[model samples]
Target chain A: MSTDSPIDATRPIALRAVRGFHVGGRPVDLVDLPHRQLATVPGLQPRVSNPNGRYQVGQLYVQQFALAAPTARYPLLMWHGGGMTGATWECTPDGRPGWHDYFMRKGYDTFVSDAVERGRASWAPACLVSEMPEHRTLEQAWDIFRFGPPEGYGAANGKRQAFQGQRFPVHALDQLAKQFVARWTSTGGMALDAYVELIRRVGPCTILAHSEGGRLAQHAALSVPELVKGLILVEPAGAPSTAVEDASRLRGIPHCVLWGDYIPQNSLWTIYRRQVDEWLAAVQHAGAEVTEFDLPAKGIRGNSHLPMMDDNNWLIANLIHEWISGAMEGGMSG
Target chain B: MSTDSPIDATRPIALRAVRGFHVGGRPVDLVDLPHRQLATVPGLQPRVSNPNGRYQVGQLYVQQFALAAPTARYPLLMWHGGGMTGATWECTPDGRPGWHDYFMRKGYDTFVSDAVERGRASWAPACLVSEMPEHRTLEQAWDIFRFGPPEGYGAANGKRQAFQGQRFPVHALDQLAKQFVARWTSTGGMALDAYVELIRRVGPCTILAHSEGGRLAQHAALSVPELVKGLILVEPAGAPSTAVEDASRLRGIPHCVLWGDYIPQNSLWTIYRRQVDEWLAAVQHAGAEVTEFDLPAKGIRGNSHLPMMDDNNWLIANLIHEWISGAMEGGMSG
Candidate 1:
């Protein structure tokens, strides 16, 4: 549609109202230390813990984009993947207006949230100490996600080659690379629990989950189905197992599984797809309406693991808008 | 490097000089019909074949972008893939300046050409009669290239899903879909032969070939090594075989094989990579300065098969420029 010039028109127009807030934080006891006494000691350099060490855990950071006249029955909530923040939906790595604003423009109140200990949800020392986490380097992402040539970087060799039709903006790769934060192995459960709580407070709504956020979405939907009306899963890292009881509880609720290009070659993604398929099958058998969206089948190409942050993200957003509108038109409780 | 704003700065500046011309065309006799008799007939108006019909089997079309003070010692000849015109190197599908302009800006005389029976090289009836060809549908590309979800299009399903990280410009997808020309199975050999001839005429240049264009580049390099100073292969469809004789002839020749992302998942590309590896092995054994660029290895991600028309095409062009300059600095003979 943008033939004369290539520009990102995905940014949402200024909404009637926008707000930011914190959700689901629990208070912690203060830690008292001999700060003055330690400082008085001559030779040894004194270190003191903050006198107000009282902190919050399981709290999340959320930014809401509200439309004055909502078109949909329920607000759309966006949950980010692991080691990421609410920023995932705020603006694209390429600096385009992200899904948060796009969905807002579509007349749906949009809520973007960062999970416990990620992004704006500052983590407590207890949560961080549970397991040592590692930061993912840009090189690791390049290879794992099949972004470009698999080798050659460092002073000896310059930047490696990117894949031929990758949708992620390689020009802004450095900016995107900075978004990969340290992730912990034990944080999934905590994040999911917090997300479920957030859903309860927000009331019934449609949820869009990506990667690790899939777990939270699934858990919340199952644990409190009353709060969730629909599910849009974009390459979820894991899916609800057949072992999940009362799959029928999700009956009548619309669920769509979205897959991008290059899934077969990615072992991890293949496994994830298998799990998702199995889960979707179980849900279907349980009488829930399950739809599978294979991007390649629809004539869309060259998408990576992070479709929301991709260059063609607007197209994906359009697709989501249509699906969401259709689902909500039937009534949010359907 | 562009962090403040994400803009495609790949567009080329107005060149100091530019020109276009046709190569490898020959005279053909025009068919003459009995004008009076043909006009008398209603439905079957005229049908006559010239007794002296002379046709050119393999001619091509070329456009050259020249710089007054070229930095590189040799010119860069760009050969497009199957069913594609020289436009592949002219501008990106996302509206960025393509490799043709990018390399020209780097101070090299760049030549982009259409192969026999492709684009500007209109084919004769004889070529068409050689074999039946099939036009690639958007559906086929969506699946084969791993562009989008592998299912859902047409009336049955209104829209399809895009892959997560695909880099192809989805907004311009319909426009790009129109670019998929019908490809004949039997035309490969003809195109390769014509390309080799073109190389001989051009003399001492660097060839940048993509996908199907790789075959022509390899054939030309092997048949007439003297004309080729350096080789830059960008995701060539096929690689050389072990059967190559006198492999040492390419010894000391600077050859760089650049691969984009998302190859492992695509079967055809996987096979292509294997073959390319075999050829690279042989080339190395023969002592050529062979450089393999695995984009993912270098931390570049989300590339599709058509890097030249991708969003980061300028980056790929920049890489080619560096390699060419380095190769030329050591002497074009290498």
Candidate 2:
């Protein structure tokens, strides 16, 4: 189960449709550049002046893969973590099928999304946006993603130490880095709004959100609890405090939180874990069914922050499938 | 056939696998900014210093959808135009099945790519890259994409004039604009190299390239003619001069160049059309089989630069499919 076997490339997938679209965001009128020359595309003669018009900004991009005969009652919406795109769920760094494929194969319609300001969810100009974009350096990703100890990356080969049982393909970390994107600091509110819009468009559905997207999923669920049938948060970077959200709104919605190994070792993740635990406790206190899986505790060891991209991703996916099946049944009975 | 009917959402698509990977690009070592505070992520206590390391740069991101059963001899590589990602081929602006789906349904393994410095192909830090990235404004897009004449956009309703027979869904222009990404001017060479690498990995295949991607596709074909089985250039924005590339290298390859309506009215497109025509003449002169489609002349009218995203996109896709089938057959016989 912990092996690095690749997905069978020849396995057939009976898909009903594969399509994509942009959702949410509002149009903003650009009136300031009345006569500004259009020089974006290189080498255009008789430069045309910028026209004052309405332009869309801060939208989300979603790619959907519908199954021919879906067994699951609800669709699965996959939201990637910070500095990543829907590509995160499309394939693993080591070139295996990602969670998007696994769930689709499980006979659930899958919608993988790139949140606002990331990937196909194109960004607004600096003037239109509230803050400048930020990029994650390789050094930062290696450390924050918990592939190794803070000092493991950029260290001498002998000194480099992946958490003893780290399952991330460290050799393919560069490939993983290729999925990182420039994100904005001020788009949290905008992103949350878009997620809610997404749920409105394709819900009541289950949301499988990772890292930064986790908080947005939680907020969206809270905002439209009826539409969000279930929630799965994996190594979420932040969480909504009970003081801020009415956790009781999630009373009937099932919740699952997953954490990989080496969390306690990272200071930032330690804080994040504590925050999420507090929120989960509040949700549980309010009568929501909460299931937590500390992978090491579950004997599924060697997982990195991005367990979906780890060597044993399918094993993890199988576990989640079981949880979803059980959770749906339990919700039905309750 | 030119109707605005949406794709039948429940149509089945059998696939072997859906996955993605990054290709090409060399590692860049960052020697500067040692001990720089890792402040990319906001609000992390005890800021860690940035670790200097080797980072991958200038790679292309490719998403592949392999079919369970294949009738075609080679795959179809879909490379989008400037300011756009592989999303261009995923779904049309008006939410119809794009060329990717059409080609895939026709039994060809399709690889839709986001070139270097675009979409999932991450960008480098300012220090690592040669130049700044450029954003396409809505005004420029409206004119250059040839939806209408220069004064057509931003004019009063009555004053705005779409080409009398424009077929692009003007109402959904904003949705199309949402797919536009910030692109770098200096990455053309890097993009070309990455595309060539992609060809090496999935070669003996056909390339369906649009706009800016057209130049890169031609260059890759010239660089490795044997690998490129066929070529489809859709309203390509630029072309390699015969002086720069020996078009005779494409001697045995089958080529198809498609143009939409209203090319004669736009000055910039006129130049691009002329350049591409020159290259096509040279390619044909070299004993290569070449087919050119002027949609209007062929009775398929009311198209735009992005014919793949136009209202009558299905008709255009049908034309390309017929051309591909004929070209492949011709290649085998000739």
Candidate 3:
């Protein structure tokens, strides 16, 4: 009953498919979830559970939403910023609030998984669709995604002080990203499988990430180039210059990374120069295909590391709507 | 009727447009064409000209076919390759045999204007378009498009000795393209204006250029980046690669360059490494918005330059259909 996504016009539809292997569990199948039954609401709220019990993948939880289209291509797997959880994207009861309604109406199967210790769905760790993507420990992963303190910042703060840690914040981001991608591929099927089955089932999926999650998306796309056709990042703190090199390696892969801050007072504005420089460099290498739009426009947010929620919610809704329309139109598997 | 266009479905549509200009002398508009009226003959041979001389421009002619859905956003403006006339595209009497028909049945307004000297609309003296593009030129107008010799193979044949005498082939091509675009824009505010005006009376407008014509389309797109929204090029030739330095020049613009080689002899395998090298290099600069796809396999003479008449014509026809369908459905505008 709310619109927190880019796609919000085609309501009352669902997009479902085999999400992943259920290995020792129920086969994972994701389906379009509606906002509210309107008359009979499905009590499916934020709930945390160890999808993988033995592994202390921290805490895991499932974030569900009704899909707008009956059929979908790729599922948009959302990864919230650091110190945030799935509940960060909430909708008003009237369906004027979250991304679920937006994408559902436009015809995509939407799902948001969260980790523990956040607002909602924090009782459990995020889904491991696979193993711990190569990193032996979570700290290393933290170092890769920029939520870790930037270089030159106090080493006393939560940050990686190893290996030329004296580098500039932007420079450090690239090296950190390399580490994450290296780990992701070494164990996460680097070139093992194309995850073709996943794509065939969902359609042509794209990863949506924010902040630290940006590091993960970058790794996955690079680790499994064949599987990722595109990427949609929101105010991502990607390696300022490294993305250009990273994007170059991607070749045919397309990308839309949004960042920039209208409000100079906002901390996000701090990395604006670095982010833009990196994006422009990537654009030079990849051309119009690898893009960075001026999406400084605010977007949907919740009680989390929120965007300018008030100025952005609708624009975010529009994005979801367009995404659904484009994806569902069929045959743009690229 | 014939299938050389996408203007009328039931009747064998003519490609003639109302051109106030002349060819050599007599009015460009035809009062009576040789093939406009013909009785049902024994063998079945209907010429591809129109009665109204208003369709001829310079050494060019016209062909039109009705689209399946009149609500099409853009009427496809088709320009054929070298040494080929409008008739070369047709297969059967009731139409549906050429690429032009495939698009029309799918609801796209179709029109084909002949090239000046059996090459492209912009060829030789009265060529329809040009292709040369340099940083200086781009800076002159911030060119969004350019046309010229398809990354050529003059080296193999030693065919180019002086670029038509001192004028680099690239420069000559771009100049032709520049003039063509100037005419189109000046006459109707961009080639799509008349087509769009006509279609708006009906719906939207797009473009489809084959072989040499493909180059013209590219040039047109560059001439008025804001005006031309989408393009479909058929086995285009002479796509000069933008050197690394040049690569830095092209920052914005979307391109959908469709390549096909139905014959194995004409396969991408046969494509020169030099051409590929430059293409890739330039693409590196272009980025992800461009979509490149391989066409069905065929032979050595399988390209747009001199596609073996008869069956190979399907290559262009199929491309046109897909291009129009692509533009109409995808609406790759801006």
Of the candidates numbered 2 and 3, which has the greater TM-score value?
A: 2
**Worst 10-residue lDDT window, candidate 2 chain B:** B37-46
Best by lDDT: 2
Q: Write the per-residue lDDT of candidate 2 for residues A38-74, one digit (tens) a residue.
A: 3423344435444355567879999998888887889
Over the stretch B148-212, how does candidate 2's per-residue lDDT look in tens digits?
87778757764556888888888787788888887776567788899999999986898999998
- In the order shown, the chain A TM-scores of the predictions are 0.86, 0.92, 0.51
Model 1 lDDT, full chain set: 0.62
Error of model 1, residue A165, in angstroms: 1.6
Q: Looking at candidate 2, what is the lDDT of residue A324?
A: 89
On the 0 to 100 scale, the lDDT of residue B251 in model 1 is 69
Pick by DockQ: which candidate is best? 2
* For model 3 chain A, the run of ten residues with the poorest summed lDDT: A18-27
Candidate 3 at B53: error in angstroms?
A: 82
**Candidate numbers sorted by lDDT from highest down:** 2, 1, 3
DockQ: which is higher, 2 or 3? 2
What docking grade applies to model 1? incorrect
Candidate 3, residues A122-240, lDDT tens digits: the string is 11112333322211122323233223333423356645453222111332232212111101222212111212222333345666666645544555565565666566666664443
Q: What would the TM-scores of all predictions be?
A: 0.46, 0.93, 0.30
Which candidate leads the pack in TM-score?
A: 2
Q: Quote the lDDT for B311 in model 3.
A: 32
